[model samples]
Target chain A: MFVAWRDLRTAKGRFALMGTVIVLVTLLVGLLSGLTAGLARENVSGVTGLPADRLVFAEPPDGRSPSFSDSAVSEGQWRSWARRPGVVDAAPLGVRTTEAAAAPGSGGGTGGGAARVAVAAFGAEPGGRLAPGGLAPGRVVLSARAAEELGVRVGDRVRLGPGTAAVAAVEGDASHAHLPVVWTALQDWRRLPGAPGGATVIALTTGEGFTAAASEAADEALGTTALTVDEALAAIGSYQAENGSLQLMRGFLFAISALVVGAFFTVWTVQRAPEIAVLKALGASTGYLLRDALGQALLVLTAGTLAGTALAAGAGLLIGRSEVPFAVEPATVLVPAAVTVVLGAAGAALSVRRITAVDPLTALGSAR
Target chain B: MTLLLDDVTLTYEDGGGRLTALDRVRLDVPAGTVAAVVGPSGSGKSSLLAVAATLIAPDRGRVVVDGADTAALDRGARSRLRRERVGIVFQQPNLLPSLTAAEQVQLMAHLSGRPPAAARDRARELLAAVGLAGEADRRPHRLSGGQRQRVNIARALMNDPAVLLVDEPTSALDHERGAAVLDLLVGLTRERGTATVLVTHDREHLARADRVLTMRDGRLTGA
Candidate 1:
């Protein structure tokens, strides 16, 4: 990088402009990545956080995707799944979004008015791990968000359908389809108004001997489809559409970054044609020239990406706690920065190929 | 032992027809001598230097630098020959604007894959030889015209090339600076035993050449 290094030092203005562009693009992509992960968490953390490795839904007719909104697992299917070989445990889990009103003299009474919180309620049977407090019939566990919204604590009664269940505990801040969770018994869940179906889906834990044959037997017996945890994410309708659009936007950002880099280096290569000719005449090989050019690009890209990543991470930390859904995992921040650098280098590589075609003979008279 | 061009004929495609730049031109310069090629505009002086420097292959001629025939060599081989054996001082003082005077000369060593530290002493010596010892750290834009041209000359010889090909080295300088450059070329040719070919249109600097060759209409005379 004899000339490349010196050019970078001497031509600071040009490279600064290019580096600014890279930084801004990386910042935009990184922020979007965080938001995408945060929003996705809100959409599917309920299913993803399940103790079972897989969830079984009532099979739609042939050639259709599984849908949580459309699935309703019956008791016969749950009993059949419990008897299947290689099935360590099968638990019936019901899910419904409904309005719940806290007891009049509970924490809701502090304001002297009823506090009705919208929550996604889950139902499981007695002795099943899905049950809130080990089959205490009238006890319910509320997620932190749900508890906060309803202004109820333990030993307080919250009305579900026609019955009032005592709050057992306020657990982790888990969400389902953008709403907080409220756990109740499966029988009590069925009794809730507007919850016409018995159970939404069946959560399954499979042993090591699990096989396709076992799956087929369970599916036939249960009359439900089986999906890995990852596959079940598509069952959430909003998650699919929202994640798809965010991913598409992220893809477009990557492409645009590449194009912007390509355009900048194309002009830079053209501007450096004379220098290339002189170097060629000075016996600099095509390979050496390319390495020098790409090394210069890597230096600039790495600097710009790191700066952008740090800025984005700081911004995410500031806003993640707020209402905006922004997740700041290593995968969310570092991956996009890495992609930007690789794609930008690839773009610059395409432009620097013009170096090989420069005629050293031109340097004899053209070097002015 | 220096430079030899044997019956070289170079042509170029011009407007769907062949325009001959050098027609069967033969030239030679032994070691420790300077041969200047003077011509009017478009008289193939630059073409002759280009062929001798191995930047262009002649249509029908052999270019022999230090007993190696470049016509039979591959592109890589030709570039290697140029790197190790041939040196060209361009028409313009084509110093990379980013490098200082010493760095410009040291770059020649870097191109040949030599360690930069190993080349530093030699770069300083060459710059001193060209009377640029004090301006070694000055970039091209900061140096005077004469100093930049001298740096250009120092860069060309840093590789210890057997044949030195100079093209219009004094084009951008005044007479005093041009004379100084010409004298430096003549002195370097004598001291280093390099066969030097200096291409120029200026008649005043002809006295520095051991032999002066004039070209007209793509033919050489008055050698």
Candidate 2:
């Protein structure tokens, strides 16, 4: 990389401009990746947090995929699922998005006033198989986010659909469809407005080594469809649409980064054709030239990408807890950086392939 | 002989037909001498030098550089042969804009798998030999035309090749600088015992050549 290194140093402005472009593209990709993961976590954390191997939903009409928002299961379906051979446990779980307000003139809230906070309520039997904690009637468990948003602590009176209820202990931080979850007794949940008078979905705990084929057969026999926890997240309407859009944007950014890098190197290699020819005439091998070009590209991409990813990770850390739902894991930052470098290098390879076609003879008789 | 072209024939496609650039050309340059080929613009002087330099494989006949038949060797082998035994001074300086005077020389050594820093002393020596010692760190754009040409000459000699092919080294210089370049070529050829072939149209600086030949219409004769 002797020539490659020197070229980078000598043409500092040109390389710097290219490096800056890579940095910006990588930054955009990194931020999008973090946000995507954060939103996904918020959308499905409650469902994923279920201690069940599979989630059973009521079959939809023809030509429609299974969805949590549209599916409602009855007590008969849960009983039939519990009677299956491999089914160890079948618990009725209900999901509903509603508004929660602190009781008027309550001393529990920090704001000194009752404000309606958007919340998602998950209903289960008290000390049920899914939650395992005793949840009596007229009380609800608030996730950490719910507690913070409502400015309410334990032992507070909260109003939910014409019922002023005492707050049960806020336990696990669970959320569904971008809203904080409130776990309540099955009886109390049935009394809330818009309650379908039954559980939304049945969480199933299958024996070890459970197979999808067996689950399919059971679903057919019970007039219900079932999916693994990972697959069931797609049933959340918000998760599917939101995640798809963000992923598409990230894909475009990757492609654009490759194209931008490719275009820059294409023009650079074209400009250096004469120099390459001279080197060839001096008997520098085609392999040697290729290594130099590729090495230069890799160097630029690595530096720029790492810098951008670091910037994104730093920014994510700064606001991860207070401002927004940003995840700063290795998957969110480093993996995207590696992909950017590889794709950028691939683009550069395509552009620099033109170097081999340069004739060394052109270096001989021509004017410089 | 370090450079020999025997019955070499070369042609290029032109106007929907073949145009012969060199027709059965024959030449030999023994080690420790300079053989200058003078010709008009289209007289195939460059073609002859190119064939000898192994940049072109004649359509017929053979090119033997340092006693290796380039015809039998494959493309990769021919390139290696050029690196080990041949050096070419192009019509233009053709210096890489990124490299300085000394680094230009060192690049040739690097092609032979040696570090440029390891060969820095030799690069400085060669640059000093060519009277560009003071311009060692200057890039091509910073140097004068003659100095750039001299740097080109120094780079060609960096690998200590047995055969040195020069193409119009002084075309871009004044008469004095051109004469000085010619003198340097003659002196380097004698001192290093290298076989040198120079292609040029200028005959004013003919005294330094041990022998001179003229090419007209793809034919050569003693001058």
Per candidate, chain B TM-score? 0.97, 0.97
**Against the true structure, candidate 2 has what lDDT?**
0.87
TM-score of chain A of each: 0.94, 0.94
Error of 2 at A264 (Å): 0.9
Cα error of candidate 2 at position A295, Å: 1.1
lDDT for position A55 in model 2: 90
Candidate 2 deviant stretches above 4 angstroms? A104-113, A132-134, A162-164, A366-368
- How much does candidate 1 score in TM-score? 0.95
DockQ of each candidate's interface versus the true one?
0.54, 0.57
| Candidate 2 chain A weakest ten by summed lDDT | A104-113
Residue pairs with colliding backbones in model 2 are none
Task: Quote the true-contact fraction of every model.
Answer: 0.57, 0.65
lDDT of 1 by residue, B1-223 (tens): 5788888898888889998899889898999999989988888988888888888898897889999999889888888888888888888888888998999999999888888887999999999999989999999999998888899999999999899999888889998888889989999999999999988889887888889998886788865
DockQ for candidate 1, C-alpha atoms: 0.54
Candidate 1 Cα misplacement greater than 4 A, ranges: A61-64, A109-112, A132-135, A212-222, A366-368, B221-223
DockQ of the two-chain complex in candidate 2: 0.57
Instruction: State the lDDT at A60 in candidate 1.
Output: 86
